[model samples]
Target: MAYPFKEILQRFWGYTSFRDLQEDIIESVYLKKDTLGLMPTGGGKSITFQVPALAMDGICIVVTPLIALMKDQVHNLLKKGIKAAAIYSGMRREEIAITLDNCIYGNYKFLYLSPERLETELFLSKLAHLNVSFITVDEAHCISQWGYDFRPSYLNVGNIRKLKPNCPVLALTATATLLVVDDIQEKLGFSKKNVFRKSFKRENLAYKVEYSENKFNRLVELLVQHSGSGIVYVRNRKMTKELAEFLTRNEIPASFYHAGLDSFVKDKRQKAWTENKSRIMVSTNAFGMGIDKPDVRIVVHFDIPDSPEAYFQEAGRAGRDGEPATALLLYSKTDVSNLKKSFTNAFPEKRFIRTVYHHLMNYLQVAIEDGIGRTFDFELGKFCKAFALNVVQANNALNILERSGLIQNTDTRENNSRLYFLAGKEELFGFQNQRQEYEELIKTILRSYSGLFSSYVYISEQTIAGRTGLSNEQVYQYLVNLDKAGLVKYIPQKKTPTITLLKDRVPENIITISKSIYEEQQERMKRRVDAMLYYISSDIICRSQILLAYFGEKKSKPCKICDICTSNGQQKDLSGSIRKAVLDKLNRTGSTNINELIRDLTYDKEKSMEVIRFMADNGDILLEDKQIKINS
Candidate 1:
């Protein structure tokens, strides 16, 4: 009994055919074989697992480290009438439990969770109860130690095989080295070695690196040259706003984006950029994941990225529509040392790490042998000010602890106010009858929102207040009161990062940064920094080749469209060789077809055309009826 996969594609996506290698990967998963798919950044990686999972009988479990991607995909799937849910950092334990239970009983088609969730005791306890079709790992390179963005939490993605032994795994990544490829397959416990690769080449996208002292002018020049939608990636939140303002001052339509912005604002600005209402978006690296804008004509890096993988993925955002575009990097003097300093700041001394951990525990008020499974909102600026610590080093230390799996400090995420009715309708009616004072608010809530009884649903206190003629504070109090009465579980909206204690708090001396998380990881960061430095400084190698080789594409030919090749083009002596050959051919034949002459020339075809254009411009040749003739 097989489902019509092609019909499923048309029914869901309204597509006549699959993109390159999508069908094969889908077919491979349908056969229940573990697979590693290396797709380009904009390649349709989601379709591989989605089509197959929809055809299969049970829910598909998708694991990814990016919360933005989880929310984006879940929202999109829900819009398509596909039952989906997401569990990631910052979600309440109750919400996670409810979502997992729904996945078990509600006939959901997809459940997206972060890799860290896989190792949680709650998730582990519920694993055996799920009727899973398969597990899909996005950004699978994180599981490999050799990968640039390795996370110890990602290791637990492999442990699921023990519970769902027959559920095949599909791992997808935009970029991976040969070593990473093998490591991913082994770590995931693939039954046999199988890899599906889409070429990383972007023929229409040109990669460029520019060196100039006046960076702002260069940026303006680029914007003027390429008249279309673009992205400008900087290094910090401040830079995003400043650059965007500057661009706007220069008469360029621009907006800024970063994680710190309110969720509504972020969505609004992202929408503006996507719809071409804003011609340019100046942002930090947080802006690009899970966005589906295809006509991006250019992506400019105002500052260098940390690793080749990061750079490649960011730059690859352009030319997504298979049209001509440019990925330009502006290199400056200070960037090199700044990147090197970042590596040192990323791995503080072991003693300092322990010190930071102790201070964090004190800040969160977690006593020894306690605090496990509890989450506290962590404000870095406040904590650093309190401890008189360097913000950069303190942040790095927190990351180290997170990688060590002692705690989880995630990025700032926004959660809307949500509530779930714990009691059935009859019980709620009885409770409302008893509590007549809350009757109006309850009725308004029931009229305004749906799905509260079955699961959590977004609720707005202000909107409820407007409708009920009550103050916003009054509405909030009523919701809290209802939660306290055990009739509802209500959580207020928040935009803060939360640090969850993964293990029991211990004395400062007991905190140990393992070698894998510290020393070796430092070496890896150094190598990445060095790779970035080498990429910008070296002028002879094709930029594309350098990036491709870094990803284990050793046999790739030079792109010929990168900065190095074009620079070589400028220095190439086409006048001496191609010039005389064209003259001799024209003199012998008197005149020849311009295409035929360049096609017949043995020299480089592009160089030959350049020489022909030079002759035509300098009055050395005559063009008539698509033929070339020497000036008489």
Candidate 2:
């Protein structure tokens, strides 16, 4: 099948040429084959499907769980003169029906929706009438039980493929293990294992790990030395701020980001960090999923990540512009201990999981076989306080329930306040004149914004308040009154977690959390944790090779720039065995007196002392009084 891909790219994206494997992946899909494209974080994964869908004859159905991403892409596509529509939770039934009707009649080239939407009777009944050129499964890793961040909703995509059997499926993911790769293909029912992978090797990004006694000082020294835009990843919201302030105290301009922040604050801080107004961004893993600022010089992990997939995805954010960058992990013994505890907390017992599910249903007041298509704003702190549940354990149980397909909670809250005029201009004018009380607010809104009658427009409460000389709270009340009066359709701004029930509330006993969802996933987490543990401890292989081999790449050349490779010469002289033996003993046992450790080494006394001194100087070991210990 011949495609005018270059013309489409030039016309819409203004790209003169396609990146490494993009054209090939697009061609394979264009030829009506089930194709999986494994691209890294910065790889042009979207273009593989979008360009081909545009070149084809019909609309492309995109299934993804990221509502924010769907809206963003649909908006960008519309800006490029390509009609696109997105259907997700929180939309009124009438609004969804209108969108589906538009897709059936209008020649929209793209229809982006959540995976849960595919099985809806409304969507399925309309599916037969629409010409779907292809199906694009974004974040395709979620279909695999072994993949990090698995979502049960993604499994329904195959059923949709069976309905549109002629339409090819293009699965795209940023990170996947070998197990996840095969699982994705099998679960998606591929005709054959036709996969296109852009190599995961980032030559410009050097991977490094350090065992340090004082990680904070080490972090500061790294930032001082590197001197460019970098990210420091900590574990929780509180730590993000503390570390960012720590960096600032040391004269490093920094910002912090987490899911808990207000949407406007998030945007402001993110813009500052990305535009180089802030030299460092100390954040949780929540930051940097879809952000596309290349040329990041370094990424510092203050704590260890459980999975290599996550580590790779987060670390890949650096060196995206192909310049020299470094991914540095600073770990201590405490961090390793914390990571193990986290693994246990991430998968609670099945009975406890069931109990949490029951409590969750009760808390939401969802009756059995009811509220299947409903969405409720969820606040973790409030729920935990009411149930007296440990925040971490309860949150983990909810995730397990989500993986079991009972409900889904997108932990991030978004969207600003939106208003749409329900009554026409004449009717609104007459009501405002008669009501008299709502006159100024109505006039203020009418003069301040456009498109109120046509569609939903994002309106800021603060902006409205400033203009009308009313407090923000008062403005909110007035908007609610107007909504009740049928003068406008108002959706107040939300920054709370939202849970969407995918299935009717079932009894806790009947909720079957599958072995694949629980046991195998637990085992997968253990493997990822072990691999990460080994990656830090191993000195015989290059750091990059350890990460690459984890993702199924073997026989890659050593990146002579990584910590292991760069230190090889010293290791050759001092004997890597000496460094390995000292660390191994410490890991097995606790801190040992320096005299006893030296005696146990069995090497020449002076040589043993030399190795110990080298380690201590490199910040890998610490000595207090006469006792010696591994730094982390």
In candidate 1, list every pair of residues with a backbone clash. none
TM-score of each model, in listed order? 0.84, 0.84
Q: Compared with the true structure, what per-residue lDDT tens digits does model 1 show for residues 62-176?
A: 9988877777787678768888888877778889899889888999999999888898889988888888999999999999888899888889988888789999999999989
lDDT of model 1 at position 440? 91
Q: Where in model 1 is the C-alpha error above 4 Å?
A: 1-3, 421-450, 458-488, 568-632
* Worst window of 10 by summed lDDT in candidate 1: 568-577
| C-alpha RMSD of each candidate structure in angstroms | 10.0, 8.4
Worst 10 residues of 2 by lDDT: 568-577
lDDT against the true structure, each candidate: 0.86, 0.85
lDDT of 2 by residue, 1-632 (tens): 55699999999999899999999999999899999999999898889999999989999999988766775687678668787888876666765676787788888899999888888888899999999999999999999888888888899998988998888899999998878899999999999999998889999999999999899888999999997899999989999999999889999999999877766577778888888999999999878866888979999999999889989999999989999999999999999999999999999999999999999999999998898878898999999999999999999999999888888786545566778888998898899788887889999998876556655655778777888899999999999998998888898877777888888998899888899889999998998898899788765457886788778775466678898788848644354567778898888787998888888886667766755765664457887898888787
